[model samples]
Target chain A: GAGVSQSPRYKVAKRGQDVALRCDPISGHVSLFWYQQALGQGPEFLTYFQNEAQLDKSGLPSDRFFAERPEGSVSTLKIQRTQQEDSAVYLCASSRDGYRGEQYFGPGTRLTVT
Target chain B: AQSVTQLDSQVPVFEEAPVELRCNYSSSVSVYLFWYVQYPNQGLQLLLKYLSGSTLVKGINGFEAEFNKSQTSFHLRKPSVHISDTAEYFCAVILDDKIIFGKGTRLHILP
Candidate 1:
């Protein structure tokens, strides 16, 4: 079965530039999530979506981060004014429903702010 | 809020040797535990999960985990490991519909 997928596997951007990362969740998955992973560190939560609603965004570090899932199947995480601190791997995951279900993750997009 | 801790930053073991990766979590509410493996340049793959039922849970690639609610620990174990098992493993807990992960443990398999 096809798993979650993300695009722009690697990206390099100048400081202050804006970048958008895309994620495609598995079919019929009711839950979508985004995370950030720094080098040698565990992934930190960014946001979560249930269907088309943005349920949780507390883990998004700053106001510069914004995420949206208009149709409930695909999502985008956009960062305005890219900074050195934003350089990390952005991971996407999908699950059947809520907390108890297992999440399937995407390969992630590595963003390097240069 | 839930927080996870992976006690070891790295673990090295010879091929075919047994291994254990320690994980502990803290939460005021009931939690669901999980273990994920990430190969180089790859996304995380679910190794196993402990939601309920038996405390001993078996997962993919010959991996198993023991859930200890009293200890707030979900440690991953393998009786025998292959070279391919070398990767980053993460311990995570889900509470209030949010998933929190630990710093992760890097497994190095020596031939």
Candidate 2:
């Protein structure tokens, strides 16, 4: 579709298991972002990419979380050695250009760690 | 640094009644204000944004917001609400590429 799309709408992982979430941003969008939303909370920024460069990732809770957009289109968020605290909905959004006020978002991937 | 505050965690209104969701923000530099809506089991969609121009902005689904720079506030409103409008609303600000979001306000439409 024209909007952003995410894979594996839902995921369940055991403690110590690694998980990967994929996001396909809108065609040719210049800016992409990842955010984590816990239950009853708003989304918190995780990382952002302008083209193929990761400019900021300060919101990433720990080193266990990593994100990449090697081709500047499809991106992946990886969580290594996941713990219960890692459970949340992972959201992906994209803007037509850098610093654009409007952004398109995907349905998001719900991750549950047991 | 930028931050958004949604004072009301939950707001209830009967169908067809008007409702308002309050939001406040703070930023040292130039910023953009936004309102996002999230349905159950879904991600967030932009409802409206205040970039530049008129203080009032209109968005999809009969939603509107007024940007008050002096008060640092952007509150979302709908003249009439529906049960379908029940969802979590988030207020956010874009400051130098960082989007700070509020905890959100859940709009409960009473039948």
Candidate 3:
């Protein structure tokens, strides 16, 4: 079976531009997660979705970030205004049993803000 | 809130030699511990996890981790590592519905 996948593996955006990263979770996966990995650091939680209903979003840094999983399978993380500090790899993960199941990760989308 | 701490930022060991990456967490209640490995230009892969019962947990690629409740630590170890073992390792713990990760330890396999 295919693992989780993210689109736009690499993206470069101007400081004020907006960007959207996509994620495709494995089929039938009910839980999805988004994380931000800064250079040389561990991944930080961003947001999570359980079948289209976002359960936890306290990890979101600020109002500039927004996410949606309308159909419960595909998700998108949108950054309103890019900043140099926003440069990092955005990872997406999915699991079958919500929080208890082991998560499967995607290659991630590396966003570089210039 | 729960937090994880990885004592070492980087560790270098010769190929086929033993290696250990230290991790400690702060939590008042029982927790689930996990070790994940990230290869260059790749996503994270789960090496192993410790839910309960056993203090010693074995994982893929011959990697293992021990859960020490008294020490509040879960350190990863490999008796003999291959060059492929060189990567970033993260120790994580489940907090409510989310996970908290440590800064990560870079394992450098020296030839």
Candidate 4:
């Protein structure tokens, strides 16, 4: 079975540019999560979605960050006006049993803002 | 608010030596504990989890951890580690429909 996967393994963008990171969760997964991991730091929650409904966006750092999962499978994290502070690895995970189930993570997309 | 703490930032051990990575959580209610391993250029992989029942839980690559309710800790231990085990380990706890992860510990393997 294919695990969670993210596209564009690496990305480089200039400050003020917009960037979008995509994630494809495993088939049949009902829950999806996005996290940001800075250098030498653990991943911090960004947002969460259950099916096509966005349940939690409290973890998102600011208004520039946005996420959506319309079809209930593929989710995208879009950043408007990238900043140097947004340079980090963005990880996506999926679960079968919502929050209680073990999360399966993707390889992550490393974004660099210059 | 729930949080996880990884006491050590890094631990260096010789190959074939025993190792332990300490982890503690700040939640009194029943919790789900997990250990995840991340290689240099790979995604995080689940090592093991303690949801309920037996305190000692075994995981892949000959790793195991014990869940201690009294001390509020879930420390990962391995009798002997291999060079392949060199990676970043993260301890996480689930509460309120969210999973919080510790800073993570880097395991350095020496010859």
User: Best candidate, lDDT-wise?
Assistant: 4
Interface RMSD of each: 1.1, 1.4, 1.0, 0.9
lDDT of 3 by residue, A1-114 (tens): 999999999999999999999999999999999999998889999999999999999999999999999989999999998999999999999999876678899999999999
lDDT of each: 0.92, 0.91, 0.93, 0.95
Off by over 4 Å in 3: none
**Residue B69 shift from truth in candidate 2, angstroms:** 1.5
Classify candidate 1 by CAPRI docking class.
high
For A1-114, candidate 2 gives per-residue lDDT tens digits of 679999889999999999999999999898999999998888899999999999999999999999999998999999999999999999999988765547889999999999
DockQ of 1: 0.84
Evaluated at residue B79, the lDDT of candidate 1 is 99
Per-residue alpha-carbon lDDT of model 1 for A1-114, expressed as tens digits?
A: 888989999999999999999999999999999999999899999998999999999999999999999998999999999999999999999999766788899999999999
- For model 2, residues B31-86, the per-residue Cα lDDT tens digits are 78889998887668889888889999999999999988888889999999999998
DockQ of candidates 1 onward, in order?
0.84, 0.74, 0.74, 0.84
Report chain A TM-scores, every model.
0.98, 0.97, 0.98, 0.99
lDDT per residue, candidate 4, B22-54, as tens digits? 999998899999999998888998999999999
**lDDT for each residue of candidate 4 in A1-114, tens digit (9 for 90 to 100):** 999999989999999999999999999999999999999889999999999999999899999999999999999999999999999999999999777788999999999999
lDDT of 2: 0.91
lDDT, candidate 3, B24-63, per-residue tens: 9998678888998999878898899988888999999999
